[model samples]
Target: MIFTSERLVVKTITEAHKKEFVELLTAEEIITAIPQQRPSEEDINVKFEKAIGFDGDISKNPLNIFGVFEEGEDELIGLVAFLTNDDGDRELGYRFRKPYWGKGYATEITKRMIDYSFSELKLDKITADVWVENVASNKVLSKFLKPTKEFYNEYDNCTDRRYTLLKEDWN
Candidate 1:
């Protein structure tokens, strides 16, 4: 496992998880919140490839995607990613299955990820972006990251907000 919280285990995605990962990405609620994860088969395949390719060393391969499973459960309940943006900042992103929403999993795992990013990875800063309409995600992010700005996201055709957390600012 890459990391674990009290009730969840975040680990590198593998071929065995390709099916669950695809289902999580294709859920209607997830698509509604983040339209970027289109349901097309090709896009799903590409995402699966990217996820399984993560080698657990973000410095060498900055694009890392991991499956989030409940403790002692084999099924993947969600996925989280840490990737280097164009500006070379480590950006955090996550999505959970519909059933997993409202269960405090996002906040719990996100807090752990933030701590890991700072302590283990030793990143200078971690950034995230969320659609303004995604209230839950915005709330989760606000708990650990300071809001930087809001702007129109042409690619997603919606207003989005950016947030960042510096290592020095972490508790």
Candidate 2:
């Protein structure tokens, strides 16, 4: 799916985007935000190839991973993804280059994805899990979902806060 906002374009990740995707995804800033997953350039290209033909499902749901590009330059500044959680809730995740931090781009794209999840996907709820120390992400998620739970991430060795927004509360 393609979603365009005033400052950015959120388009589905495609094979054509392999090179850019690799560079952006492996950037230090993105690695810090998404600690669990970091792939080499070759691995990223392979994943992009695999994602080319994705179709959604409740279980093993294919993600709608979009390249977040600035308005004029076709270059990507980041990425945003929506996937179905184990409980059938739509989960949102995103990361941006450090240079793009503090500019409200994350919140803007996030709000757009939330609208798509509720209105287009007809999702019942949207949730995000963010590291407690990642204050920017916490603030962004708080703009949409109230914090409902907390847990420890053994791998990252950090506390994670889970937030959610119900479809009825979205308007």
Candidate 3:
């Protein structure tokens, strides 16, 4: 397992998770919150490859995606990632299936990931960027990260807000 919280287990995505991964990528709410376009087959395939390729050693790889599942369950409900930004800073990201929403999984897994990043990975700080219209995600991120800036993303054509949390500021 990559990590675990009280109610969730995270692990590197594998072939067993392909169907659910595709479901997540095609979910309407997920599509709206992210790129806001239907994922092409190529897009889905590329992301699946990256998710499965994660080495489970973020300090060395610096970019990895993992599958999130409820403890005692085989269904893959979501994905969380630690990505390297253009400035070489670690960034946090997550997405859950619609049925999994409103159940505190996002907040739970996010907090766990942040703790892991700070304490285990030894990262000084972690960052996140959220689409302005994704209120639920913005709320989840704001709980742990300080809003640093907002800017227009040409690729997604939306105003995005960036947040940061430093190890020194963690409780």
Candidate 4:
């Protein structure tokens, strides 16, 4: 499944995208945002395998991950994902390369994914958890969703702000 916007092409991960995906996932910016403590080559390979094997079966509730690529160069710039909930809701996640930051790519891909989640997946709602210190992510989510709660992730030791957007809230 590929979704095209004005400046990006959000496509399913493939074997051919492994090398670039590894580079992006391990990039310092991404590591800082998502905190992959030891994102070695082997770890990236495992991620690639999981992403490439994703199938849109609601029962299995596979993660729908997409690589964001530039329109002309077609280079992978970031990743956006929707992990299905047991109740048919979807949790959204995204990260962009440092170079692509501040360019609205995250917001663009996010909005597109939200649309796809509701229209295509027939989901009831979409949710996101952003670290309190991640101002950029907080800003993005604020632009598209409304806050629901605040919580702490014991594993990451970070305060997370939870936001949600119901299908009817989309305009």
Candidate 5:
């Protein structure tokens, strides 16, 4: 799937986009935004390749991650995506290269994802978990979703704040 805003182009990942994904994902500064540490290029390649493969069969792809790009650029500046939880619910997530921080790209991409989730996917709810200390990310989440809960997440080994946006309330 592809989504176009006035200044951004969000689309499903593809094999040709591997190089750019690696660059943004492996940056030391960028890596801090999420739970994962700096990953080897091979690890990124494997994961990105899987996402790209799923992009071809979105109906079967549980992890619906998208590659976000600026309108005039070929580089990957950020990502807007969701992962299926064990309960079969979607958990929203977003991240961007450190250089792109403070440019409002996170907010822009997230708003688009929320719109797509409610309007295109017809989702009843989209949940999110953000590191309790990630003030930057929380600001974006707060703008579009309501804080619902908080807990310690073993996967990230950090306290997480949960947020959710329901389709009926979003519109």
Candidate 6:
């Protein structure tokens, strides 16, 4: 339930991460990139603490969500997660605070998540979806996942494009 990338640490979220976690989840960027949940300090603290209460237990839930922190910093710059869709596929999801944008952190942590999903977790495929106009997200995903489909999202009022990486296709 922990990962040490070249310059980042992917660790299970804990109550200690409340402040930075709230900052990332409630950033305005989320409404554009990921439009489902409206994160609030109180709400997130309660839910995330319970969901990831046991830091080392990856089997607790397939969500596999973790906080991304700089190697020496205690604050979280962003978060990465695996969520299941209506079709039962584990969708790769990530979001960062506005300051962290354009820093390649998203792509870095994503590669880690994808590697864990396929190589360690033995998943057949990993998928990601972005609002049709989210250029940055689309570009990052394109490196490892191929665009496969597009669907309309009534809630977000935009077309959502889907991308996937198969186990055999991962390198």
Root-mean-square deviation of each candidate, in angstroms? Answer: 1.5, 2.7, 1.3, 2.4, 2.0, 2.2
How much is 54 displaced in model 5, in angstroms? 3.1
lDDT of 4 by residue, 5-74 (tens): 7788877777887767876777776767754454767767777887787765532555666788888766
Clashes of each: 0, 0, 0, 0, 0, 0
Candidate 2 lDDT, 1-171, residue by residue in tens: 467877988776666676667766677766776555567667776657655655643235556666788887767678887775555667898887777888989899889988888877777888888888888888888998899988887766678888999999999
Q: Which candidate achieves the best lDDT against the true structure?
A: 3
| Candidate 6 ranges with C-alpha deviation above 4 Å | 40-46, 54-60
- Model 5, residue 52: displacement in angstroms? 2.2
TM-score of each: 0.93, 0.84, 0.94, 0.86, 0.88, 0.87
Model 5: per-residue Cα lDDT over 1-171, one tens digit each: 478776889887667777767867777676676655778768777778776766454435677677888897777777766777655778878788777889988888888888877777778899888888888989999999999888887876788888888888986
| Order of the predicted models by TM-score, top scorer first | 3, 1, 5, 6, 4, 2
Q: Could you give candidate 1's per-residue lDDT for residues 49-138 as a string of tens digits? A: 988877658766677788999999988899998887656888898889888999999999889999889889888899998998898999
Q: Please list the C-alpha lDDT of all candidates, in the order they appear.
A: 0.86, 0.76, 0.89, 0.77, 0.77, 0.78
Name the TM-score of candidate 1: 0.93
Give the runs in model 2 whose Cα sits over 4 Å from its true position. Answer: 40-43, 55-60, 155-157
Worst 10 residues of 1 by lDDT: 54-63
Model 5: lDDT equals 0.77
Of 1 and 5, which scores higher on TM-score?
A: 1
Per-residue lDDT, model 4, residue 8, is 88
Most accurate candidate by TM-score: 3
